[model samples]
Target: MRTVAGAPVRAGLPTPVVTYALMAINVAVFLITALQAQSVMDNGRGFVNPLSGAAVFDSDLFGRWVLSPLDVADGDWMRVLGSGFLHFGLVHLAVNMFALYILGRDTELVLGRSRYVCVYLISLLGGSASVMAFENGGFTAGASGAIFGIMGAQAVILLKLRRSPAPVIGVIAINVIISVTVPGISLFGHMGGLVAGAAAAAALLYAPQWLGAGQDRAKAVRIGWIGLAVVAIVTLGLIAVRAAQLRSEYGL
Candidate 1:
């Protein structure tokens, strides 16, 4: 892919290709889930429990629903990351993918594919962690948190490069405002992801030069890994606490 300037986009850089690829993956996953749902219903199966709560781990959709980090502790750990790609409805999916398309492609082009992917994944984990931290006993699904993290990383990059961040900042502000006004949004997840993105970007794009010639790159990797760890820890902690509570309350 080439930038609008007609310059050949370098290999290994963040590009529209990667952005679209991720979007396609997300969409494909959603389609598969929907199809599975159809098959289950056709076979006389029904989702008896609906997930409630904004926390990703604490939320459960019936006893069988398994798309939360808390489920991981119970041997359903896959949901820790899987939940980021799932969505509750078309509008939810569309909004996130659109945001990812617009911000992710451009950001990837600037940061290179490696850094871009790191930022995105870290942001996603951060969002999930935040949801687990604050809200319990509710099912939450969507990519808004991760997408917001991208926006946050972009803003940090602009600031680090000493470029005007007005455009990006304005966009982020608008989205945040909308999230507040809109009902059924996960404020905790979005905010957490945004903060994590900013922190990761700062560590990667800023930081003392004496750290090393490859210090920035190293920092980015560390940030991503650490962010994931933080999310996982908080999610598991919430599950343990909730489980204990349940045992006490219901004598389970």
Candidate 2:
């Protein structure tokens, strides 16, 4: 088990408090959206009208909270973070929460709580930025983006330990395939999260060693944070650029 700043790795590790807290927040947000939507079971009306094959969330809260390029262009920047917590329906919420629970626990152990939070948030922001850049229009919502980031972080940890990353790669490949083939999935968001998460994890896992501070836990943690800040700044810059483009093009 690799330790960071007195935080032990996987073996007999402390409770994954941050992971649990994140899961709780996601669930609570989902419940609120479900209540507002008046339907928790179906993310879209496809269940109500299987013949139409149109997927639409029953909740109006989705529009206000979902990551919409137009809304972001209009300066609703909060949606970038808020949409990561909102879910379209029960199924969407359940799948994302399960993934978060599984990947987040190990990720929290590998990166420690503070670093784990940074990776998760940066991944979320990365996903939102990608959506803002490439997705011309639509309301996107779900934790899949952040979950994909956790997957990427786990892959980075495996590489750091000289362990095979085949399993994680396989999962990512499958998810990517689904994102491509699925009608409503956000491919850009998932890819963005994956790249951001891997980059953040790589920094947290390797920057200390590169800076000759691996043995010094305090310095290592500080360097890791600095690395995260770099990733965050870049992600924010991308968001700003995309938002400006949208505003300029749409005359918003």
Candidate 3:
């Protein structure tokens, strides 16, 4: 059956627990960032109405939590993880969370919890890594990268299941269009997330078969872990090299 989330959910699939949890986590982090921003903006009090366009930024809070390629080079690599949970404004937070609620549900169901989590992390970090490697320094924050990653993974699932991949591709195309037409979207971040998600999903699904990880379930499991470990290392190494290049070229 066709679905907007890229594939149909089966009749008896358990609730998408991981999906719900991720949405909750994103919302929670946004709350923290919002409070921090409010304190920064309003004489150390509560949040401002972003809808009123009166919100002020806390550069210190943003720099600490948002992903900055330069900050990453200086050993604040944790920002890569934190940035996915941060957002520029309430509208940004709302849009990303909504998208996550939609895509994460079907994705977690199809990929299962463990692989779903891995794909999300890979996509998120991949986007940060790309931002670190290519973009100029700024406070880049949002879960769109992870969301794009889910979209890519979902497309892969539909293709594997012999379903048309057009809907996902179309969604991606529309997103790219919007990103280009609108201001402030991270293009490379989205691209990196989508590619990484697709790669991670393919690795998870096919590594066992490719490695001939046959009847020995234990052996197959080990191989899968090993493959992911190798990919993680490679990802870090590439990011380091690119980041170094950026620093050296710009003298930053």
Best by TM-score: 2
Instruction: Tell me how far the alpha carbon of residue 159 in candidate 2 is from the true structure, in angstroms, after superposition.
Output: 0.9
State model 1's lDDT. Answer: 0.64
- Could you tell which candidate, 1 or 2, scores higher by TM-score? 2
Off by over 4 Å in 3: 1-11, 39-60, 214-219, 250-252
For model 3, residues 87-174, the per-residue Cα lDDT tens digits are 7666777788889988998788777677688889888888887787678655578899889989998887887778999999999999
Q: What is the Cα-based lDDT of residue 100 in candidate 2? A: 91
TM-score of each predicted structure versus truth: 0.71, 0.89, 0.83
Question: What is the lDDT of every predicted structure here?
Answer: 0.64, 0.83, 0.74
lDDT winner among the candidates?
Answer: 2
State candidate 2's TM-score.
0.89
lDDT of 1 by residue, 17-68 (tens): 7788889988876666556555321211234335663232212332234334
